[model samples]
Target: MADDDLDPTPVPPRGRRRQARFELEFGDFEPAERGRRRRRGTRGTDDRSVTSSDELTYETADPLPAPRRPRDRDVIVEADDATYDSRLVDRDQRVRGRSRRARRADAPPADDVADEIEALERFEDAIETVRSPSDRGGGSDLGARVLVAIPAAIVAILLVAQGGWIFVVGIAAFGLIGVWELCRMFARTRPSLVASSAGVLAIIVSAALWGREGMTTALVASIPLIFLAVAISVPPGGMPGVAVTLLGVVWIGFALGHAVLLRDSDHGGGIVVNVLVGTFLGDTGAYLGGRLFGSHKLAPRISPNKTVEGLLIGIVTAVVATWFAGLYQDWLSGTDALLLGLAVAIAAPAGDLFESFLKRDAGTKDAGTLFGPHGGVLDRLDAAMFAIVAGFYVWLAMGGVS
Candidate 1:
């Protein structure tokens, strides 16, 4: 069974965070799924129950040989666009472990090809929905709006923050909810309820402790995860095998917490808003540039859509965005805005790629489509979740709001 195939039960993104608590207790990979997929390929060719390999015409012989390392290899193309990573392509290339679905529509009805096709199709559509920029306008217009809206928002928030405490409380609540979404994206799903519940509990406790004492509390508790795996004697593919699961939970939840803290800080500081604006501008520039002029792939193995040209645009945008935001908002000076924006723009993509690696390893898409046309809520916030933390740390280094 694929990571997604482990369970067909649909749950809300909020619910997924609750599930994270359960996930931590169980482990990273699931038991039943790991076993099922492992044995599927290892089964005898003559067995009564033919594996997915039986139906395919691809290589069944010796595995493909590794590529020869080129000593200063010549560029394949005049431009910078590198070829797609075989691994990433393979994930989406051949529909593996799809018991209900076949690789293509040509397959016979016994394979339940129709249902599978529809599911894949819909899921792809949902991904597109999230990827598609809102219908508000095109690049130039959007850029202008961002330029205008961002500074206005920063100024308004800083001014308003001075007037009330309730607003701070509300932003903090948003932070908590965002944290919940982060937990859900990687929650335990296989082996049904048992693993999921364990992950959920682990995160909740982590959060409760962090909420009270701070991140160090969570860090201290995470120290024993590796030794605990040995004590449990669970092999690879079991929950205990996800080497950095404990740390991952902390990274996602705690990192996101900074955004809430910044947004809701007393004395009406605009710490959080400044970081967010910077990240947003950087991402916005990269995205638009990639769409218009991107040719070279940044890291096809991790993500195909990201391009060198786009990345450059993103960096430039981050600086510009920050400068613009800082002009009207006193929270960040020219240098602070530029540096913070650049950091977020660069780091945000890394966070995105990490999540992609996780999802690809699990052989699932979008985590769960809690928000229709948007995949799961976590999918939408993956970059933001990590960016918040990165921004916060950077801010703290510079003597931030706290």
Candidate 2:
């Protein structure tokens, strides 16, 4: 063979070159299948020009699948605007898909769809109906409240009757539990519950043993311990966490500690009973009054359900209840009972609102669920904390206690 014959890129003749002898057998292949084969084989040879308008329907005999619309794109149409289409249009000037209303319009009316719409409407109505004024003060949870409150009240009375180290221990235990609940509320801040509980226990015990001075000393000393606790925390919250821990100890711990001091005083049982009766009766009156006749808000920003009418009713109820309770005890005068009731009335709501403020800031409905529907220990004692402190002062002013 010649070297020129072996060259792959040989020049064609000046005239027409002879074509190669090639044969393709189609056998039983259809016209479209043959056309597709030819097009694919001659892709870069320019044998066929595929235009944009050509629909390659022969790729498969089955029709093209419809584009899927996202389920979340279904818009909730208002009852009033049920007939209106809410389909959106993109920059491409094409409707995204059928909206909820549009689909409902196209489909024949069915019982299931109508039932779903009706159910949604009923759910909204149910929500509005349950939003009662008493929601702030137990509301539908009254049964649970009563069940829990009864035993708790009896125990508290017994503790007051038995005034000694036992009473001190009871108060200290309450302070510890309250502080724990408060610490849990500041969980994000990583405040130390153990350290805070210790601080609260110390404050309560010191108040019982060495009086106010000892309690004051413990409160001051606990600050360093709290700082150290937060310092070694896995994810420390720095100075802010320290402040939060101190708040829990002082607000809950110190407040309950005053109860110990009150119980140790002259005519302490009577004084303590007077404060409890007044505070609890006032709380109950507020709830009942608000449920029945609450229209004007007392503090809409702080506590929406509280009403001015309820507060007035509570004040009157507290005064009456305290005076009645005083009749049982010879040492507490009617006038002094009335004064104590007034003090409790003012302090209780203030304490409740203060806790509400804290809960609102913490973005929680309740501090904890220790007392079932009544909420945590803090929730049950919020008003009592302030009431006990006020009662202590009132008793001191009357020279009943040293």
Candidate 3:
């Protein structure tokens, strides 16, 4: 046989060549069903052999199952402000979903909702009860009252300027008014006639004997007598009555009497003026500061509206006003003035808080409406009364006028 005709090295067939090429380019490519087909075919024919061409045909014939069509439930519906279906989502499921979303979104917890609701309700209640300054007649009444008070204050100052009976009368009248306000406040809780009368008498006697040598002795003697009177007159179960009466005598009577004593001191008029101005400035500063920058509560239980920022402003203004008053009147040295200012700063807030405590206990907003926007005499005098008593003691301790 000719060498060309009878070729010893045979070339691969077209299908074999293609299979070899495919194996080289895409190694080990086999259809998933190839093994299953072989197994099925071999079950009947034990000697069946799987061919590469069969595997290749199977790999080429099979296509991935048609891309899955998403079901209605699988599709997420997203809308800007779309309302949910009420029939699809019941109340419980809706609430649960909302709570879950809130938690996932880092929102406030469900428990805080009740607290916020309560706070808002309280705010609404407060708004209903306390009218704004503008709403309450545009402050015209306040202005008119101020005009009236200015003259009255000037006259009192003039009376205090004179020695003897004039000062006594002025002090007695002021103390009596304060006593009346206090008695009126406690009237529903107790019979305040005896307490009011006793308080006025004590104030009169204290003022009358203020400058005398035996004044302290008389003042000391009156306390027991006042207590005894209240104790006897007040019913057995009427401790509040006795307490109010005693409180009136001590607070409205003796505490206010110190103002008279302050007036009788060497630079008495200046001392009284300094205290009054300082306290007024403190109150004004607190009001403005609270209105402007108040955030943190000072005493939420006693006075929810009071703020720490306002208290700080009040203290600073009080100190500055007091120091200026001292310098103006030449009543105290710079250092002594500063000390008195500090005292006033501390005592003024204390007095205001004290009255707030009383009013809160008595279930009223103001002690009276005599001063219009200023509330009542008690409301206006609360801080001053405390400041005066504190200033008098400080004066005595510092051995009177520096």
Candidate 4:
């Protein structure tokens, strides 16, 4: 017999009593909902029926739900695509004002929200600038380069012509500025700009006053001062700071001294002019040639733009330009001109590469921006520094100087 039949006057089960109480309290507000609940209760009772053996069993067995299929990669991907498409459709509908009220429900106040949006926009712009290429030192303007170079060339010529304390002072000024730039480049080493500048000035002045001997003396003497300065000012990374300090002194200071020595030599003005012509012309030639016909890299590791073709063209241009410049100076013979041209040509590129190496190590595109569109003082004179030194040695070898 059914359980309901057995419980005819059995004081109604607890569940039936509770259902009756709920119905009495709420009355029949919704007859359809009440009928649905009654059907569900009947089904549940059938699920827990008892057989003649007093063992509970389902009156009509309902098979267990079919086991869910394990999802493969393709099925998961398809589901994700479907979800994304649905989201896109929903967004489109919202933009068309189908859910304007719903969308505005959790939004912040208008003024506060506007300010937050503006702040976010500014932050994104700042981050974009920070993410810009680090090697973007802009000195590529040709007109600006020429404008700066012309005045600079005139000043250099005037200084070279006035060989004395004026020239020495000029060289000292260059050394000081170069020291400051180097200190800046390696600022993390905490190199003292004053100390390095003093050392460089001493080296240049001594070269002018006492030639090679005084220059050597000053270099040896300045080492102690540099050491003391590094210890006093830049206490950390002592060795690196000292090394960088000495590097500026030797590299820039010593090289510029050779320019003084060159000027002191006999017929120095014409010779200096010839060297400048060769060095600058060679540089210009290399630039043009590389732009026109650069196929193979000259030094891919040190400088990406340098090319073998450009180097050859520069050598040829230097030789021709030097020979042409030497025509005005009767003392410079064919052999001497050739030798000086080749030396300057080779040494100029070496100096340029050396500076490039330094910049690469320092992670900078230019040493400094003092020259505006031409780059730093070092950038402009890097090749000239080596070329001048090379010309001096050639002059000494040829017995142009007593």
Candidate 5:
């Protein structure tokens, strides 16, 4: 029976039998009591099927979103030989730039500083040129004047050394020239010739009576005589004339009378030579030193071209020359030589400054153009006159040649 039933089941087939089997299997699970159990069992299987299908879709079609290409910051770049070389060149350029900066920092700004210094030097040069005698067109006859003056000076020195009327005559001549120069200096003011002459005559007379017992008396008498003469010969100058006449008598007449007194001394020739040589050397040293190393002005208002360095060098040169003269002539011991040298050094510059003061007062660049480069008789004699007077007094005090 079992065999027949199994075989015939297919034969029963058709719609009615199939519907009957579906109802028989599903009808038990459709009841409210078993519905929850049926849903719970089916949900697990559905989730498994959905999960498997989604995994299959992802593997087959989606391609995993291309693994999300790494962001620029996270990316790693491998260097090639060309990249390495470029990096090295960049490093080398950076190093070169740093080196240039360092070198520039270490060096001074030479161009700017040099330009300023050069400009200052040029300015000083311009100032000097403006004040220099050569720039003022006054050195034209310097060479000729020096030529005549040197020989004439030597002759006068020789004549004075002979110690006779020659000295007296020379003194008289110097007094006359000095008086004439004074007159010329005040010519615009119409200085009295008679007063000037009387002053000069007083100098001559005082010199003539130098060794006589009445020398002081004659010198004292000359002043009143000069004043009287100025009063008598007052021209239009009035009191101005009298004042100038007295000034001439004291300045030229009295000052020059010392020269005659000095010549009358026992060792007059050596004293005169020493004073002259020392003063000349001092002047020469001043000129050379000023030209070579003049930076600071000695007297800016009075003598703009004169320099402190020049003045110092001149004094030192005068000291050296005087010292040498002392040694050669045996006129002074070493200590006395040094002392005399000091005196000459001090007095010479004073004389020069005094003459410069006079010229400034007179509104003149020089006393006169008589000796051209030497300026005038007063110019040549200024330092010598002061130096001789100082030297004579110093020697007398030291008991050297008096």
Candidate 6:
């Protein structure tokens, strides 16, 4: 054979290339039978065209096989302002003899859409974990918590103008708010105005009675006297009313009342700083350590965020915080300061988780709305009040606030 005859045909231009061909094996013929065929070649009729044996040539004289119809396309889209055409445009737009499909590529497939929805739900959960309830910026935002903390910081700082009185005022305001929150927390179950008033009265009376009338009188009044009055005013079988009322009297009334007394001292600012710094340091250290090295969950049912690692770090941080407070106050040796630090480290979180338990039982994210950016004033100050009382008791036991 001549070399020119033996050579394969030259490659066609890119645009003039034939459609892709498929190789059929014993079992691979089904898909090709279903696919559209290239219709460029016509049947033997015109002089210029060539015919291939592969195509089905139908004639009147030859017996015909069963007619084969093409399958219809199945596609559906649902949009708010949609304008889809019912007609199919068959032209050069599609490969010869092949159908073209039109739809939004960004729109996920029906099967894949479930995954996207699951991812969106996970994103929302992550946002809630990082942000506080009051930290919303018209929606979910983790920085909302910091925005709330800023105002609280400003209030704490500017109160230097009030000298010793700031502590008393701050404590008293916190006390009343704390009492109101406790009342509201249990108000839904027991909705008697008289009962609510009695609870409120019991709180105020306990604080005054303890702060002035002494611990013995306050304890007596808080137990039998308040409960007796509450039992009479509140209807029978209202444990929520009775228990919460007594709890409010002791937890808010007496503890916060003592916090005011501490703030009114000569170094009240230092005392307030001590309680706040110790409690906040424990909270901060716990959060960071837990995120970094949380191998085991601590009290998962009550507060899942806490961890063993976080608790230990919190204790160390509380000690450091108390040392700083002692330096600022210029009172107490390192040992006494360390003791108070240890006390706050252990007690503050107990108080916090206790409140978290109450909130969980109540099916509430916040105690109330008295505080705008911090849920409720009680929610903001619960730990502070608890730590202050515990620290004060320790200070008195260790020679009474130097």
lDDT of each: 0.52, 0.74, 0.68, 0.74, 0.64, 0.60
RMSD of each: 22.9, 17.1, 21.9, 18.7, 36.5, 20.3
Task: Give one digit per residue, the lDDT tens place, for model 5 in 202-242.
Answer: 66566656443344565566666656765565244334455
lDDT of 4 by residue, 1-402 (tens): 334534221121247678577545544222211111111134544544332433222222233466875533222234533332223433354446534643687866656765887666546433532343343354343445567878878888988889888888887887777778888888766676777788778877787778889889988998988888887882443566778888888899889888888888898877888888898889889977876787898986567778899999998998889988887777789888888889989999999999988876775667878887457889888999999999999999999876
Query: Which residue pairs in candidate 3 have backbone atoms (N, alpha carbon, C) closer than 3 angstroms, thus clashing?
Result: none
Which sections of candidate 1 miss by over 4 Å? 1-213, 222-237, 240-248, 264-269
Better candidate by TM-score, 1 or 2? 2
Best by TM-score: 2
Off by over 4 Å in 2: 1-141
Greater-TM-score candidate between 2 and 4: 2
What tens digits encode model 3's per-residue C-alpha lDDT throughout 1-402? 223432232222358778787555545344434322222133654544433434322333332455976553342344411222212233345668777867766667777765886677558435733566667656543355567568757775687678567877766776667777787787644535554555556665656574433445555665566556645763421445556766777777666677777887878777787888788788778867876798898998788888999999999999999998888765479887878888888999999999998987776778887766456778878888899889988888888833
Ranking by lDDT: 2, 4, 3, 5, 6, 1
Instruction: Sort the candidates on TM-score, descending order.
Output: 2, 4, 3, 5, 6, 1
4 against 6, candidate with superior TM-score: 4
Model 5 residue pairs with clashes: none
Once model 2 is optimally superposed onto the true structure by TM-score, how far is the C-alpha of residue 24 displaced, in angstroms?
66
Candidate 4: residue pairs that collide:
none
Quote the lDDT for 264 in model 4. Answer: 85
* Weakest 10 consecutive residues of candidate 2 by summed lDDT: 19-28
Would you estimate the TM-scores of all the predictions? 0.51, 0.66, 0.62, 0.64, 0.61, 0.58
